[model samples]
Target: MANHVSSEKRARQTEVRRLRNRANMSAMKTTVKKVLEAVQKKDFSNIDALLRDAQSVIAKTRQKGSIHKNNMARRISRLNAFVNKARNAQ
Candidate 1:
């Protein structure tokens, strides 16, 4: 639907970026889910590593502008809270 050459190029770039952002979001979600699962299972043996990995993914995504900085901070905060509570429970 882009009649102009520049418009067409812009559209192409937008499509590529959209796909990349979607993939990044999906990856972040998966990492968060993994951490939540660990918490739900009350399994702290490997949670530290998992939390670190999730934090890394979230930070990277935030740096890339895929997610907001505040959102990332909130997520990491909640994750750590869960991890700490779980660790202290036993």
Candidate 2:
């Protein structure tokens, strides 16, 4: 209920932060999904663009403290490998 005035202000702040984080997380997830789909279909032409977008999202999320840096790095590494393998396969 946030009976305290300060608590009410904090509640509002929390809501704002939650909304921002949700949007960022959704963007990150969408970027990852696009990358994975491109990898699965072996859409080589779009891979570079998708990879860059995904990498940027991942780096931003890591910087914002939404995700661990190592986790982001691992995902980026896997995505890069997928792109590389697809290129070599062609």
**Superposed model 1: Cα runs more than 4 Å off:** none
Candidate lDDT scores, in order, read 0.92, 0.87
Clashing residue pairs found in predicted model 2: none
Residue-wise C-alpha lDDT for candidate 1, range 8-68, written one tens digit per residue: 9999999999999999999999998999998888888898899999999999999988989
Candidate 1, residue 47: the lDDT equals 86
TM-score of each: 0.89, 0.80
Give the alpha carbon lDDT tens digit for every residue of 14-55 in model 2: 999888878888999999899888878878787888889999
Where does candidate 1 have its weakest 10-residue lDDT segment? 81-90
Off by over 4 Å in 2: 85-90
RMSD (Cα, Å) of model 2: 2.0
TM-score of 2: 0.80
Winning model by TM-score: 1
Model 2 Cα shift for residue 17 (angstroms): 0.5
